[model samples]
Target: MQEKIKAFMDEVRSRNGHEPEFLQAVQEVADTVIPYIADNEIYNGKNILLRMVEPERLISFRVAWVDDDGEIHVNRGYRIQMNSAIGPYKGGLRFHPTVNASILKFLAFEQVFKNSLTTLPMGGGKGGSDFDPKGKSDDEVMRFCHAFMAELFRHIGPFTDIPAGDIGVGAREIGFLFGMYKRIQNEFTGVLTGKGLSWGGSKIRPEATGYGTVYFAQDMLLTKNDDIDGKTVVISGSGNVAQYAAEKTLQLGGKVVTLSDSGGYIYDKKGIDEEKLAFVMDLKNNKRGRISEYVDQYPSAEYHKGKTPWEVPCDIALPCATQNELNGEDATTLIKNGCICVAEGANMPSTLDAVHTFQDAKILFAPGKASNAGGVATSGLEMSQNSLRISWTREEVDERLKGIMKDIHDSCIEHGIEADGYCNYVKGANIAGFVKVADAMLAQGVI
Candidate 1:
C-alpha cells in the first residue's frame, strides 16, 4: 500500500513539482483516499484519482487596470475549474498579492472534497488574481475587479461556474465583479454568491465559516460530554472568520482571548467580549488599522509583534489565518499548554506536521474541509434562494447551516473512526469526501 501510494505521488509530483501548495493538498488526500480505494473493489480498477488531480479546465489571463495615479498596472489572473462531477463548479475568488496558479489549484482541489462533504450539488473550483486589494482605493479596486471579470465572464455562468469571496475579496469586491458580469451577460442570475442581502446574499453568510467552526468544535466536545461553556478559546486572525468566531464563542459562553492580522496578534487576558470583538471588526473591516492599535484602545491587552497566538494557553485553538500559519512547533506548544481541540477556520492553516502532532496527541482536531465549510455551505444556500427568488430569514438560514454542520460531523465520525475508537477527522473527511465524488465520476463514465 505504501509503495502504491509512493508510485502514485511520484507521478503527480513529476507534473506538479513546482506547485508545493497544490502538491501538499493532493498528498494529504492521497494518503487517506488511496488506502480506502484499495479496500473498496468498486474504486480499484479506475484511474479516478489521476483524473481528479488534473483540472478539467485551467484559465489564465492578464488583467490590466488603472491605479489612482492613472498608472496602468497588469496582473496575472487564474481560474482553475478543477471538477464538476457532482454538479457545476463552485468556489471563491480571492484577490491578494499571493494569488498564483499553485495556490489556486490547491484551493480548488480542496474545494472538491469540501463541497462534497456539504452534501450540496456543488463541485470544486477556484479563481483569483495577484492584484493586491490592500491599500488600493475603492475606485482602484473596483476597476481591477471589473477588468478581472471581463475576461472571467466568458467561462462562468449561473449553471456553469459560481464564485464567492475569499481572502482580500469581500462584499465590495463581489459587488464590482458581479456588476461587470451582469453587465456583460445582461441578466441578474445566481452566477455569484456573497452579495448584499438587499441584492441576494444569504443571512449569516459572513459569519458562517467562523460560526460553523465553533459549532464543529462544540460537536466534538459533545462527544466527550463537554461543551464550549467555561472553556478558554484562543483564535488567530481578525478577519471575517476570526471576528465572528470570537462572537459565536462568546455567545456559547467561552472565553476568546486572541485575534491577529498580518502584523501581529493581540492577547487580551481578560477575554475579548462582544464589545472588543466589535472594535476589531471595525478596525479590520472599516478603519483598516493595524492590530497593534488594539492595545491602545484597551490598555489591558498586550500586542505581540511578529508572532502568532499559539503560545497562549487555552482549552481550544482555532487557526483562522492563512495556509501553513500554524506549524509543528506551534502544535507542540499548544499541546504542552493543554489545548484539547484544534479546529481550522482557514483552508490548510495547519502544516502537515502540525496535523500529525495533534492527531498523535489524540486531541479533537477538525480539518478546514469539515469544520470551516460553513461559508461555502451557506453560499450553497444563497444559490438556492437565488434560484427560488425568495430569501429565507436569518433564523431559517442559520438553522439550516447548523443542521448541515451536524451532518458533516456525523459523516466524519462514520468514516474516520479507527480500531482504537479514536476518530481521525482528516482521514474521515478525505475518504468521506472522496467516495461521493468518486462514485459520481464512476456513474458518469470517466469524463
Candidate 2:
C-alpha cells in the first residue's frame, strides 16, 4: 500500500506538475484503495486501480456564441469520461467561470465512486464550461447552450453519456441543450436529466439532491436517536440544491438561517421561511440578479459580502456550493458554534483541512459521495424510465429516492463503522464506492 501510494503520488507529481486540487482528489481515493487492494489478493497485480484513476477520454472544445449585442463570445467546454466499466458515463455539466480541465477531471474521478455508491448501473463522468451564466440574458444563454450542445451531442446519448445540471446549468439550460440535441439528432429522447416535467424528465429530479442530503443526514442522526426537527441549520448556495435543501430542512421542522452565492451570503437569524425563500427563488432563478438584492427585498436580512455563513452559528451545515467553498477556518467556526452534523450537497465542498476538522471533532460528517448521491441515483432512475419509455410520478420518484438514500446510508455504516461504534462515513463511502468499481474492473481483466 505504501509503495503504491508513493508510485501514484510520484506519477501525479511528474505528469500533472504539482496540481494540488487534482492531487488532493486523487490522494483521497488512493488512501482508501491502496490498503484495501493490498489486503485483497484478487485486486493485487491487476493495475485496475491505476487505470481507474485516469480518465478514459477527455473532450475539450471551443464554444462560440453571439450575445444580445451581436458580439461573439468564446468559452471552453469540457467533458471528462472518467470510467465506464459499470455503465455509460453519467454526471452533470457545470457552467461556472472556475470550470477547467483539472477541476472537471477531479469531479469526474470522484463521480466514478459516487455513482458506484448509489448501487446504480451507471459509470462516472463530468463536463462543464468556463462560461459564467450569471449575467447572461435568456437569448444569450440559449445560444450558448445550443452552441455547447452542438459539440457535446455527438459524444452523448441515452445509452451513452448523459449530462445533467450543475452550478450554472439548470432547467432552462438543460432545456436549451436538450433542444439542440433533439434538433441535431432529430429525435425526442431522455439524453439528459432535470428536464421540464412536461418533457421526458422524471419527477422529483430537481429536489433530489437537497432532499436526499437531508434524508441521509436524518439517517445519520437516527443513529443517535436524533432528527432534524427544531434544529438550526445553515446552508450555502442559493441554487437549486441549496433552495431545495432549505425547503426540506423546513419541512422537517428545521430552521435554516443562511443561503449564499458567489457574490456573498445572506444571514437571516429568523430562519429563511417559505416567503423569504420564495423571494430568493425569484431573485436568483427568475430574475437572475445578485444576492445583494435579497437584502433590499427583505430588510431584516443581512447580506455579507465575501463571507461564508459559518459564523452565524448553527447545529447543522450543508455546503451546497462549489468545491472547496468550505475551508478549515469555516470548519473551525462551525465546530466552535457547536455544529453537530455536516453533509455535502455539492461535490467536494469541504477542503481537506475542513474534513479533518470534522473528523477530529467527531462530528457526523458524510462526504458528498455518500450523502448527496440522490441526484445521480435519480438520474439512474431517469435512465430506467427512458429505457422503458415511461415517466414516473413525483411521489414514486420521491419514494425511490428516499429508499436509495437510506440504502446508501446503510452501505456507509456497513463499510465505515469503526470498532468503537463510530461510523466514519468518509472511509465508509470511499471503501463502499471503491469495492464495486474495483471488483468490476478486476473481472473485466485489466481493462
Candidate 3:
C-alpha cells in the first residue's frame, strides 16, 4: 500500500472505527489511485483521496409505515450524499434487509468514482432502507416507499441529488417513492430514475445494468478477438440485473444456462431461451415468486437448493446478486469449470479472494463500478432528458448506453494495462474515476 493510502486508511480507522468491509472498499480504490497520484505530482499530497473517502453528508432517519396487517412498522432509512465536486450527487437507493451505515458508505464511496468514470456530469451518493420488499404486498410496499421518500425527498432534487434503483428497489418501488415526492413537492421532476415510462422514465432503464454488464463483457471479449456469440454463460441472481443480463446474452447469441435466486439456482441444459426467460420475469418480477416456481413451470430445468450457479461449466459468468455473493470457492469452481470471464452486475458481488482468484487465473474480470455503471450512466442520461424536456427512444437510449459502456472499457485499458498485456479493469476504473474527481477537487481547492 502507498503511504498516502496507508495514512488515509489510518484516518478512516480512527474516525469510523475498525470496520473491515468499509476498509476493504476504501483500500481497493486507494490502491489504484495512489499509483496514479504518485505519477501525477499535482494530485500528490492534495488530500483528494482523503476528501473522496469521507462523504459530504450522511442522512439517516426513521421510516414508519403500516404493513398489510395494519400493524405499524419502523425501519431505518439512509442517504449518503457522498460527493459533488464534479456534479450533483447521483446513485441508487437499495432496499434490502442487509443495509446499514457501513454498507451504504462503502457503496456511496464506490459510486463517487463510478459516476466519474462514466464521464457524465454527476457525483456519487447512495441511499436506502433496511426494509425488504420481497414478499411484501403492493400496498405495503407503497406505504414503505412513501415513508422512505417523505424523508428522502427533502434531500434530493433534479439538480441536487438523484437516486435510482438497486437490489430490492425497482420500478414498483420507484413509482411509489416518486408519487410521494411529487405529492409532497407539488412538482413533476426527475427526482428519481428507474420510474415507469408513463412518468418521464427513460426507456431501457431497468435493463441497463445487466445489459451494460454484458456490453462491458463484450468489449472485454472483443479485445481477445471474440464476442458473446456462441458463448456459454452462467449468470447468478434472477433479479432485474440478472434477467436483463440473460436477455442481452441471448440477444448477442450467447447461451445462458443458469439463473439463481437467494433460495437456489435453476439449471437449464438447453439454455434459458427467450420464452423461458419471460416465464422467469413473470415469476420473479410480476408474481414476486421463487426460483422453485421456474422448475415447476419448466419440467426440463433442474433446481438446486442452497447452491449458486457457478458450479455450472461456462465461458462467461455474471454475478448479479448482492455484495460478496461470490467468494474464493465460487471463483475456483467457475475457473475450474472453464469460466473465462466474470462480469459483476451487482455492487461488489465478488469477494476479495474471488477477485484475486480470477485475476490469478487470467480470467477477464470486470468490477461492478465499471461493468454495472450503465444504470447510473443512463440515470445521468435521464437527468439530461428531463433537463432538456425530451424523452429519448429506447433504441437511442440503448445505443448511447452501448457507447458509454465501450467508452468505459476503453478508459479502463488506457489507464490500467498491466505488464502481462491484460487490462486491470479494477485499477483502470478506480484511477479513471479518481482522476476526474481529483482534478475537479484540485481546481476547487479543499472543501
Candidate 4:
C-alpha cells in the first residue's frame, strides 16, 4: 500500500516538481486517496488521479495598466480551469504579489474536491494575478481590474466559468472586475459571485466562508459530545474569514482570543466581542492598517510583532491565513498548550508536517477542503439565485449554508471512521470527495 502511494507521488512530483504548492496539495490527496483507490477496484488502473491533477485548461495572459503615478505596469494573470465534470468551473480569484501558477493550481485543485463536497453543481477552478491591490487607489485598482478582466472576460462566462474573491480580491475588486466583464459582454449575469447586495450579491456571502469554517468546527466538536460554547478559541488572520469566524464564535458563546495579519497577530485576553470585532473590520477593511494598530484602539490587547497566535493556549485553533502559514512547530506548540481541535479557514494553511503532527496526536483536525468550503458553497447558492433571478434573505442563505455544512460533516463521518471509532476527517474528506468526481469522470469516459 505504501509502495503504491509512493509511486503515485513520485509520478506526480516528476511532472509537477517545479510547482511546490501544487505538489504539496497533490501529495496530501495522494497519501489518503491512493490507499482507497487500491481498495476500490472501480478506481484501479484508471489513472483517475493523474487525470485529475492535470488541468483541462490553463489560461495565462499579460495585464498592463497604469498606476496612480501614471507609470505603466505589467503583470501576469491566469485561470486554471481545472475541471467541469459536475458543473461550471467555480473558484476564487486572488490578487497579491505572490500569485503564481503553482499557488493558483493548488487552489484550483483543492476547489475541485471542495466543490464536490458542497454537493453543488460546480467544478473547481482558480484565477489570479500578481498585481497587488494594496496601496492602490480606487481609480488605480479599477484600471487594473479592468485591464485584468479585459483578458479574463474572453474566457469566462456565467455558464462556462465563474470566479469569486480570495485573499487580496475582495468585494471591491470583484465589483470592478465584474463591471468590466459586464461592459465587455454587454450583459448583466451571474458570471461572478461576491457582488454588492444591490447588484445581485447573496446575503451573508462575505461571512459564509468564515461562518462555515466555524460551523464545521462545531460539527467536529459535536462528535465528541462537545461544542464551541464556552470554548476558548484562537484564530489567525484578520481578513474576511478571520473576522467572521470570530463573529460566529461569539454568537455561539465561544471566546475568540486572537486575530492576525501579515505583520503579526494580536492577543486579546478578554476575548474579542462584537464591538471589538467591528473595530477590527474597520481597521482591516476600511482603514487598511496593520494589526499592530489594534493594540492602540483596544489597549487591553497586546500586539505580537513577527509572531503567530499558535503559542496562545486555547481549545481550538483556526488558521485563516495563507498557505503554509502554520508549520509543524506551531502544531507542537498548540498541542502542548492544550489545543485539541484545529480547523483550517484558508486553503492549505497547514503544512504537510503540521497536518501529520495533528493527525498523529489523534486530535480532531479539519482540513481546508472540508472546513473552509462555506465560501464556495455559498457561491454555489449565489449561482442558483442568479439563475432563478431572485435573491434569498440572509437567514435563508445562512440556513442553507448550515445544512450544507452538516451534510459535508455527515459525508466525512460516513467515509472516515477508523476501526478505533475515531473519524479520520482528512481521509474521509479526500476519499468521499474523490468518489464523486471520479465517478463523474468515469461516466464521461476519460475526458
The order of the candidates by TM-score, greatest first, is 1, 4, 3, 2
Which of the predicted structures, 1 or 3, would earn the higher lDDT when compared with the native?
1
Which candidate leads in lDDT?
1
Residue-wise C-alpha lDDT for candidate 3, range 61-130, written one tens digit per residue: 9999999788999999999999999999999999999899989999999899889989999999998999
Mark the regions of model 4 whose C-alpha exceeds 4 Å error after superposition.
none
Superposed model 1: Cα runs more than 4 Å off = none
The residue pairs in collision within model 3 are none
Least well predicted 10-residue stretch by lDDT in candidate 3: 15-24
lDDT of 2 by residue, 290-333 (tens): 77898888889899999888887899999998889999998999
Please, what are the lDDT tens digits per residue for candidate 1 over residues 309-363?
9999999999998999999999999999999999999999999999999999999
Give the distance in Å from residue 422's predicted Cα in candidate 2 to where it truly belongs.
1.5
TM-score computed on alpha carbons, candidate 3: 0.97
**RMSD per model, one decimal:** 0.6, 1.3, 1.3, 0.8
TM-score for all predictions?
0.99, 0.97, 0.97, 0.99
List of clashing residue pairs for candidate 1 = none
Q: Please rank every candidate by lDDT, starting with the best.
A: 1, 4, 3, 2
Candidate 2 backbone clash number: 0
Candidate 2 colliding pairs = none
- Candidate 4 on 1-447: residue-level lDDT in tens? 888888888888887889999999999999889888988999999999999999999999999999888899999999999999999999999999999999999999999999999999899999999999888899999999999999999899988999999989998999999999999989999999999999999999999999999999999999899999999999999999999999999999999999998999999999999999999999899989898998999898999999999999999999998999999999999999999899999999999999999989999999999999999999999999999999999999999999999999999999999999888899889988999999999999967
- Candidate 2 lDDT at 445 equals 70
Instruction: Output the lDDT of residue 1, model 1.
Output: 91
Our tally of clashes for model 3 stands at 0
On TM-score, the stronger of 3 and 4 is 4
Better of 2 and 4 by lDDT: 4
